[model samples]
Target: MANRRASERRPSDRRASGLSSRRPSIDPWRLVPMDKTVHIGGSDDFNVLFIGAGNIMFGSDEGPWNHSFRFEHKLGRRLKVVALIDPAIERATAVLQKKCDSFVVSAYQDTRVFKTLEDFVKNMAPKDRPRAVIVGSPPMFRGSLAPGRDIEMQILKFFPGVAMFIEKPIATGPKSEIQDAFTIAKTIQDSKTICSVGYMLRYLKATQMMKHIIDENNLTVMATIARYACAYESIAKPDWWDKSKSAGPIVEQGTHFCDLSRYFGGEVDMSTVNAHSLEWDENAGALSKMAVDESKIAPENRIPRVTSATWKYDSGAVGSFTHVVSLQGTNYSCELEVYADGYMLKLVDPYVQPTLYIRKPGDDNEQMVRFPDDDPFFSEVSNLIDIIEDIEEDPEAAQILSSYEDAVRTYELTWAIREASERSREAAKLKAAAAA
Candidate 1:
């Protein structure tokens, strides 16, 4: 079915469909009402520092939905990019010259590029320090177990209390590295630093509406079913196909859904998690039929074609997620369904056009709410700025939905799912060996 836009809907049609024409107001963390009386950062310049110049920070040829570029467009002349720290300094320079227009280039004329964070820190004066820092480095370069090696630790230590916006999959490495990365959460908490993980979906209008409905009805969530089917065939990165580098699809890609599931179901019981996957093989019903060549990589290192996982939330609610890496082109099939006693809430196509479907008690038909041209990335960054601006006036002025500590839990859950699926694969192999 084609998604209908809110602008296209007539006032009478919205009333008949039980849809409100009014936009949902942004609530502070914990559903607290926002105080409009407090003055946010006005026309003053908002200085920001970037840790990486990759696609997440600056838009690549693949897409133009990057955070740095979006923030520049949003803030205009008031946004000051103090500097960018990256090993490949040329990449940042290229992005400024090629991807951006004259206005952006002129605004960022003073933006410097450094080969490393240490270099940038040494040269930059305290007066030029940014109030906000965005870390968009590769997963492997983020949260490190070693002191001075982690981006988060360095920022907190040097620029005390600076607001941070770290990209998703916070860290990717072996089991030891992931566990070590978890330790950074406490440092962020103790320092009282305002940090937000890049789980932009939580900022979506449809997601907020879903939460509003669930809260209004005082519904007990029974289950959350989510599916993420990506366009793996079009993936060009070699590291992405390798489990060792990318932490497999579940940890790397499907984490968005896993985080969302936790968002609705509350804390998850790690012990209750179990998972299974469809391995790639020449046999029928195997992932080999997809036509992607994975013969070069060993079976153990290659990512699963499909992963199915289930877990129980601390609320006693069950949840299940399925991730499939078998779609063509960029049309990813993603959706989440939440079931309560007598209501069902389904959010679909979050990446492009987000549409929420609601079916309440005694209603055989589902009501659809379309959020067109909704950019969660922009919302997340804009909200972060608001928090940074108003934090001095009221410590509780703004709330970060996905804080560093909260994101660690989601990271642990994804790792648990990956571990469970590997165990299942090993068990199947042992059974076949015994039969042979």
Candidate 2:
């Protein structure tokens, strides 16, 4: 996780510290273009590795963001992809050969594809080991490389303090699974690993600008509200509907807002949160003794289609989060709003076509700010490269937002909300049985 302010710096000192006055000088109409060519680098360039070879890496961008594609567009030949590890060696090789083109393969030649991470790490010389790693594997496979060891722990075993960039929804559902993630998070903190999670939205220029405004104005945030409602018709996989594999929409898709809430509102108290869920039913649309089959889904992933939850942050700020995946067609919405002293901010669609809206408190009029070349996915890779360069210069030069330890708390908040809904459903079932 990230600590934005030092302990010695009081909240009241923020406005006077001059840090808030340094606002981002970004033009709304400026179009930032991604470079098509990779900059050539010498043999002593930074070496990196990729742990997964699926859609997030090789597939086409569904909307406007794809991790591997963005990295290639930005970093190019400046870095070397020393190895790519996946269970299916053929798939990994195909992804590289087909998706990467000849130029990329030529720029990074020592890319030895391996069937497993164990094989790659064992075979490579200590000097040849990667200085950084990108983990794009699915949530269920997160902690499964070994029997009980989590992905972070396993990686730390071989390479302590390695710069790691892990994908989000840090872990799958179930309280025990969350606890496992929590343990690993603590371990990561203890080891002081240079790590960052794939909460790429936080890397958006628009988000940074909003944070700047909040700090500059010394606004006392009252509440942060977030909503994510999307149509599932375009989703290609059935397991996405099956709660077991995908962790439903909340953990799978809507986690961005949950993390944003913590970003603006500060740390949360699990005991101060409560949630309620709604599902479709036949008779009077009333909840039944068993309206849904919990067995059909994994215990960790049995999230409802619609959920509303509220929590109180340690800073005395109140927050709310809502998620829905029942819409049809191509309509979808994902955004977060902050109600602070004198001004309110609305950050819209950080994944693609990000924009920010600022309004005077109690006023209806709002001003829209947009960026043509705001590539958050690319920005995230750029940050990683910066960390790599920092480490190359000095091992302690790396500082990042959205680190793995920070992301685990977001995962915990989602799990707590799901658990609260589960408890409510069970109580309804008991009441129904008593009436019968």
Q: All models: lDDT? A: 0.78, 0.70
TM-score of each: 0.87, 0.83
Error of 1 at 19 (Å): 26
* Candidate no. 2 TM-score: 0.83
As for candidate 2, its clashing pairs are 1-406, 173-300, 174-300
Off by over 4 Å in 1: 1-41, 61-64, 99-101, 147-149, 282-293, 391-398
RMSD per candidate (Å) reads: 9.0, 6.4
Residue-wise lDDT of candidate 1 within 304-369, one digit each (tens)? 888899999776789999998778776789999999778999999998888999999999899998
